[model samples]
Target: MARLNVKPTRMELANLKDRLKLSTRGHKLLKDKQDELMRQFIILIKENNALREEVERELTDSMKEFVIAKSLINELFIEELFVGSETNVELDIHEKNIMSVIVPQMDFNIKEADVTSDIQYGYLNSSSELDEAIERIESILPKLLKLSEIEKTCQLMADEIEKTRRRVNALEYRMIPQLQETIRYIQMKLEENERSSIVRMMKVKDMGTNN
Candidate 1:
């Protein structure tokens, strides 16, 4: 059973009334917050859907290109050209905040392995097509990483929206009603006590007059 902490006296009742007013105001603000969160969540879902489709398409294309590149590299006779050269690849990535969302930031440097100045076997690189393919791969990598971050952020926001909605619903459908009920009960009890006191006082006065 829920009870309001209303005082037996008028002074306490006045204080309780003020508290009820504040509680109502807080409830309204929380409800508004919940609504705003839900709206944002819906928007994010739409954006995420579009992003997902784009990322899938791009990744599919990238994978196809990757297979072709791999096959070409394997068939290339670059053993003499790559001799004594070292391959050094470095990737530095970090997260940055944007509108409470964390997105990926990346910097990458790639050094060809065993790149010899000899051109005898360098003919294996037959044309700049492989160079272009590698550049595209590098370019698409960051985009994929960014999409991953965005998708994760969308999920996180969705979870937060769900939690906020639950709280709002509880306050609207349960807590507020219970509080109002308790207040009503307290008011009724107080009124009954006042009436009983009045009756007792009247009876005592009548007995004294008769004496």
Candidate 2:
């Protein structure tokens, strides 16, 4: 760390000391905040990994079911069945604060009961595989929404951690050291001035005694 460019004086020393004290305290607090943010970030990462794996597995299963259904049913009929279905989903978004970082929160609401209910198509013509696939996909919606929220939260937290880490490094490596060095220089100058003044006084006193 480079020493600060400052006047070597008692007043400058006092000011620098005060600044050093404040900088040290701020650095400690920032360090603590960074640690906590890392902890939360790690936990979110783990959750994201696990949720991603589970979602992938369920998606594979659903896709397999869909493929089987497609093979067994008429392609035109399947397309018509999907085109006739009406389903609506609403999402509510908000924010929650964690360790000074705001992260997203989401809530999903399905507009109609039929969204998850049995398919309206005639059973005589439609295969059960299609119904099973649709149901499986519908069941995974909530988890998918939750996964989205978690992933976004993790991103926000990671950004905050990086920001905090930078601040802590600035204080520890630059500002605090500069202030300390400046204060030491000022104290040394004051001590030297005091010693010089004492020596002059003693010489004057000895000359007066001889006269």
Candidate 3:
């Protein structure tokens, strides 16, 4: 509550009053924005947590199947099969706005091919476990990518929410109060000046009447 270092005049008081009105309105709007951002951020966090859990569970299952496949197949044969494999995957990145924050959206472009035919190794050479493992791993890639995108979005939104919260607090606690104090100070000064002028006029009239 420090008063602003401004001259105590009618025009200055009027200006301060207008500025306080604008500041109060702006504070309300900013507080509302911060509240909405927090709501949206919480939703994103829950979604990220669920997606992360699902991705982890699928990855664990896929890894277990891969370990079993490795034990059943020749190590050199596994290396050779992967070395000659042809799988094309492309990612297209784009942006989307959530509450004025731009976040990333990713889309996968997988080249068209017969997945069954793409298993280049002979069916007899590779166990069914190996085929299943490969399929599961491939299926997890898109989900993993989606999880990455969601986590990043959550981080960015969290940062924006924090920034907004700081601004709202500053306006609510600091600027508005200071403006109010200054306005009160100016009004008091103007009232005191008005009383002094009236008293001086009364004294002048009394002296003239005596003469």
Once model 1 is optimally superposed onto the true structure by TM-score, how far is the C-alpha of residue 202 displaced, in angstroms?
2.4
- What TM-score would candidate 2 get against the native? 0.92
Query: Least lDDT summed over 10 consecutive residues: which range in candidate 2?
Result: 111-120
Assess candidate 3 and give its lDDT: 0.86
TM-score of each: 0.68, 0.92, 0.91
lDDT of 1 by residue, 1-211 (tens): 4665556566666666676687678778767766776676678678778877877787677678756765666444435323534556567878765434354556666656555455542445543555555466556655565566567766766666677667777767766676676677767878999999999999999999999
Candidate numbers, best TM-score first, in rank order: 2, 3, 1
Candidate 3 structure quality by residue, lDDT tens digits, 9-123: 9999999999999989998888888888889888888998998899899989999999989888878888877766656778898999988889999898766444443335666
Query: Residue pairs in steric clash, candidate 3?
Result: none
- lDDT against true structure, model 1: 0.66
Give the RMSD in angstroms, all C-alphas superposed, for model 2.
2.4
Off by over 4 Å in 3: 112-120
Question: Which residue pairs show backbone clashes in model 2?
Answer: none
Q: Residues 1-211, candidate 2, lDDT per residue (tens digit)?
A: 5678888888888888889989999999999999999988999999999999999999999999999887887788777777667657798998899988988889899654364544456766587888899889888888888999999999889889989999999898888888887787788889999999999999999999999
